[model samples]
Target: MLKIRIIPTILFNNFKLVKGISFDSWRTVGSIMQAVKIYNLREVDELIVMDISATNNKSKVDLDLVNEIANETFMPLTVGGGIKSIEDVSNLLEAGADKVSINTSTFNNDFFVKEASKMFGRQCIVASVDYKIIDKEIVIFSNSGKVSQKVKFIDHIKKMEALGAGEIILTSINLDGTMKGYDIETLSKASANVEIPIIASGGAGKLKDFTDAVKNTDVSALAAASIYHFTNTTPRDVKIYLNSEKIPVRIN
Candidate 1:
């Protein structure tokens, strides 16, 4: 059995770690490197650090900062935002990212997934999908959730899989930072539609929420922000709770 991964997602504004509600009204969390150091001490299974600025600013990947964080950690680091082309993916992995995640750039250039996966291997590509409830239906959001891709949520997931994206980071823009709970209907639909690992993201508020998501849906991992940023529930605590509940997770 595959041990479900407990991932702490760190968002960066410029070089500083930041957090927000519904992907807006951003606030600083701390320095990027410091956050990674804290997670390292916690012996987290993996860490996902995203550059929240690069896409909005139309900038390039901050390879220097990414490299600095990568140098401080022992586990896998997945970096996203500002990933535009194959060379950018190359630079991220070269700088120390175990995998590269792409979102906004994907709509216009999905072939990047296929080409990068072909060169870097499928396991190195993660497609971050942000969805919102529009007209009571879930649809893909792009440009940091400010715009819609006008693509049906599940169809996009299928496209990503067909294009060779190895994993899907499915996040609910409506539930982001709300601490309500994950969007299970969306998670289940995506997980059922795709054979690749699905990283269920957004709205993870407490320990039971974690258990409920995995128990109810076969997502490979659970990723969250405010629950870890604002609460005392560390990823290790989550793993412990999951183990007590009989959920298979990698324990330290």
Candidate 2:
């Protein structure tokens, strides 16, 4: 059996590492290189670095900086934000990213996902989705959660899978950065509808939050930013806790 992966997502505003609540009011936590070295020491399973300011600023994904960080870490590195075409995907991969995530462009023109998957295997493509609840219904938000897809969340996941996404990263806007826990109901529903892997992201506050998410749903992996950035918990400790709770995890 495959052990569950504990992924730490790193957000970048330019080159500075930052954390925010519900995707707003970002405060710089430290430099990206420093954070990368720390996670490397902790032996994190994977790292996701998203350039939060890229899309809104109409700039490209910071490929140079990503290339620099990818050289520093040994874990699987995935980078996202401002990816518009197949060339961008090639550039990120060439920069040493194991996989590339596309959000706004995928929602706006889903063919990008299909074409990227076709060009460079589905395993290299990740569909990153950010969403919020409105009127007791889940709504898909894109462009870093600033715009709405106006579609049901599960439907979007199915569409992404059909378009050949290797995995889906589902983030809950209301629960993001709140450190409450994973959004189990939404995550469960989304995971059940897709055959591909679902990586649970956002709202992981404590060790129980991770256990609670895996127990409630079959997430392939759980990801967080604030808790890992602001707290003293290490990946090794989390694995120990999960193992003690009888959950399958990879001990580092």
Candidate lDDT values, in order: 0.90, 0.90
lDDT of 2: 0.90
In the range 1-252, model 1's lDDT, one tens digit per residue, is 789999999998878789999999999978878889999998898999898788879997688988898988899889999889888999999999999999988898857888988999999999999998878899888888887877878889999999999999999999999999998888988899999999999999989999999988879999998999999889999999999999999998
Off by over 4 Å in 1: none
lDDT of 1 at 207: 92
**Model 2 over residues 1-252: C-alpha lDDT tens digits?**
799999989999878889999999899999998989888887888999899989888888777888888888898999998999999999999988999989999867859999999999999999999999888899888888899887777788999999999999999999999999999999999988999999999899899999999999989999988887789887777889999999999886
Per-residue lDDT, model 1, residue 130, is 92
Q: Please provide TM-scores, in order, for all candidate models, with all chains considered together.
A: 0.98, 0.98
True-vs-predicted CA distance for residue 173, candidate 1, Å = 0.6
Q: Which TM-score value belongs to model 2?
A: 0.98
Candidate 1: the clashing residue pairs are none
True lDDT of residue 15, candidate 1: 80
